[model samples]
Target chain A: MAKSKSRTEAPQDASEDVVMQELPTSHQPDVQDDASMAEVDAEDDAEVEDEEEIEDDTQRVRLLPGSTPTAASFEFLNEGHTLGNALRYIIMKNPDVEFCAYAIPHPSEPKMNVRIQTYEGTTAIEALQKGLKDLQDVCDVVSDKFVAAQKDFKKKSISS
Target chain B: MDYDPMAMDEIESKGPVIKISQADTVRVKFELSNADISFANSLRRVMLAEIPTIAIDLVEIEDNSSVLADEFIAHRLGLIPLNAEGIEELQYSRDCDCEEYCDHCSVKLTLHARCTGDENMQVVARDLVPSGDRINRVLGTPIINESSDGLGPLIMKLRPGQEIKLQCIAKKGIAKEHAKWAAPSAIGFEYDPHNKLHHLDMWYETDAKLEWPPSEYADWEEPPQEGERFDFNAVPDRFYFNVETAGNIPPDAIVTEGIKVIQQKLASMIHDLGETEGGENGDYNGPRSPEYNGGGDGWQDQGFTTPYGNGGNQSAWGGGAGGTTPYGTTPYGGAGAGNGGW
Candidate 1:
């Protein structure tokens, strides 16, 4: 089963790589070298503007164009399977979501792309928001229970 | 929201439950029930790599006459867990406003040991004195036999006339950057002990049970019958976790901190998404225009709309386009299957 799954997945991975490679050049060109040299002249004027633009350019999440309400792909910066897998699991649990999956464009780059396909009634964004909210709720409960358990254990040890 | 007793009861029963079987300053064993494997795995991974702790990140040696090399002693010092009680208030050095390091970002520790007498002297974690009152070595409990004097982990030994003097800068960091910053020494996670879910394949010549004995945790669930029909569709919902800390932070606190880290990550992602939602036409083209163009023309034009989208998808990647030619299949479809259908 695993072997056949990999075979079917091989071609798809190749295409995603193409997207990853083309993304950088289109957004921010070779402006860093020019910006650094310009910094010595103005010091604060153009340098601050360049820094702001760079910050805006590196926004953590971006919605890919051509995304419909029901189906969409989102690119996440500086994220990996740690958030991706958990979010996928939570999103898949919602009955409105038809499919949910996440992939890392490349190992070297800390980026994750998540695709969510929802049923007709619900939008992909809504499903994603719900997934994030649900995951947060789960963590809240886990933390609370753990803290309470620890306190109980400590009290038991002290009394005994 | 309307209060429905039946709905409330169902939600309460389905919510995750955590039961701590054993807990101490250095170790904890717990069972997380009513949760999926992915959620449990995330928590475990975060604990191992994301939850921050204080460790000696920089060392400036002024004198060294000990047998160990300077780098070796520095490495050892980095592994020693310091008290991380107020770590939440401490800022990462990179984020701090100070030039290099300050009290807000780091704590200074100095160790000056010399053996002038005939006998050899032992330099341990306890010997490193902290400049701040809040930071110190996490003394091991005598009950665990960690040490007779509770001096902490040994760094090195100095012979007569041998001396070692060094200044260490302990800073907050996560294990993802360096192993020394990890709070847990070990974390064990196990699920589906009977292997009824077929998550693991047992290899045995004659008897599978003999070759692959059930783990101790298997007792928590009933054993499969000799000729019982297995539920192939059953998913493992219960997870057993054993967390052993390195004494910098309490074991129970580590689990909570890990969960909080996951929560923070999700919250941050949600916040970012909300910020992009305000963009025109519901399209986010902030700095990721290249991604937008690549994904739009590259993915959509190739019928890489959805992983399991309907046919006619073949035409999208049917061929003429040079961009699509590099990646023949639908991009998102490949993304879904490539990530092992996560």
Candidate 2:
């Protein structure tokens, strides 16, 4: 994937996004990028995150393979939360994850694909549900802190 | 965890989904019936560390007249992942009985450079020549095929007043011993199955009574029966797989090679088990290929010792250059010099 560096950067600055960033992995990425390494092998795997299908409020999860509790896909339509990155980060947190990765299949589709891989007894769907719920818990804590910060700012303004 | 992988039959299962983005990288999604996390974990672990490939383990620097230190050049040379085709034809040095080197064990590469003219010049990987007849320098891409994109990374630089000569020995080994011989730059699989959509809203934004798998993913021949979509909307147990190469080997070759290694290891284990159990139960008829001894230590020793080849040898043609003789014997040996840099 010809991922431009600028594409992976946070969208705070328009022109600041110029470098593609690699997804974090269990091993250090430095040794892999040897200076003498042939450039052909340096093709970046990252992609420009699609910011279209993002809705900050809506969250959806669809069970795949019909009724089986084996697999599931979580799609965020309008929330530009970068859930794939978050979910992949969560998967990495689990040393037992069979497989985990994020994909933005088509350039026209703004949806992120967060797939969970499990085997034997633990179904991927269960792991996915757990991850989503855990993420929500983290978000709730962040939301509370934001509200507290707002109240503090308001009090400071009244005193001034 | 309770299921035995060996007992499981290859059911009439669906094919794996494959998506190749570049020549060096590929993504695959497939299902494993009657298999568990243990099996998947083993495959991933073996592919990363057990699968064998060629690497420059030892370097002989006869003369170093360049600005860079001797170890620096040697380290850089070891890092270049050679084109690993026909790797199955080679043998791990530990398994080979040759004292110094042998055709079946190691391939020799020589780099002899000197500044001929008064003008300033540079030396590159194009100067290092692998005994072409004995070893393949990976096909479809040359060692120093520098393009506009600079996909061809440089090996070393030389000056007009400098001169250098050394012999490099390439041997078969796994990533556990050193990263130079690692199978893939990146490899991991996830569960991704062909999911079927129940209703209209469960799929795309279309209202029409769509067919199973809809139309975008209509590659499947036989669509699901009426009232049942292929669950094209949700795939269970199916996973996304990715594998990248370090330019020496293609992504597909590395994947196939990795699988081959895993199969061999499993087959050996099964054979060893059958041999020991058959003696007690009578009539053991499992395919016996990689023979194992009657004790636990033999198996464990085989598992640990042979994987890493003999390292730390800097002999200057002293018990070294095991397969160097094959170079002159091959018709292409002399011709290899004309192929790379002058």
Model 1 RMSD, rounded to 1 decimal: 9.3
Q: What is the C-alpha lDDT of each candidate?
A: 0.74, 0.48
Structural similarity of chain A in candidate 2, as TM-score: 0.46
Model 2 per-residue lDDT tens digits across residues B1-342? 322112212343222222332231333222233322333444456567767778887899999988889999999888776766777778888667689767688878888888887876666666667775574445212244345243345666666678889988888888878988887777755442223433333444563345334443234324456776354433232224456566556555555555455444334323333333333222121122122232123223322111111111211121333312223335666532233321
**Which docking category, incorrect, acceptable, medium or high, applies to candidate 1?**
acceptable
Stretches of candidate 2 off by over 4 Å are: A1-160, B1-37, B116-120, B132-142, B145-152, B188-236, B278-342
Expressed as tens digits, the lDDT of each residue in B224-323 for candidate 1 is 8899897866778789999998677878888889988998898888887886677635443433344333343443543333333221223222323232
Over the stretch A8-121, how does candidate 1's per-residue lDDT look in tens digits? Answer: 777656665344433464443344575566556677667767765655444687765546677777788888998899888888878788889999867998878899888888
Cα distance off (Å), candidate 2, residue B133? 4.4
Off by over 4 Å in 1: A1-58, A151-160, B1-12, B132-148, B211-213, B280-287, B291-342
Error of 2 at B300 (Å): 22
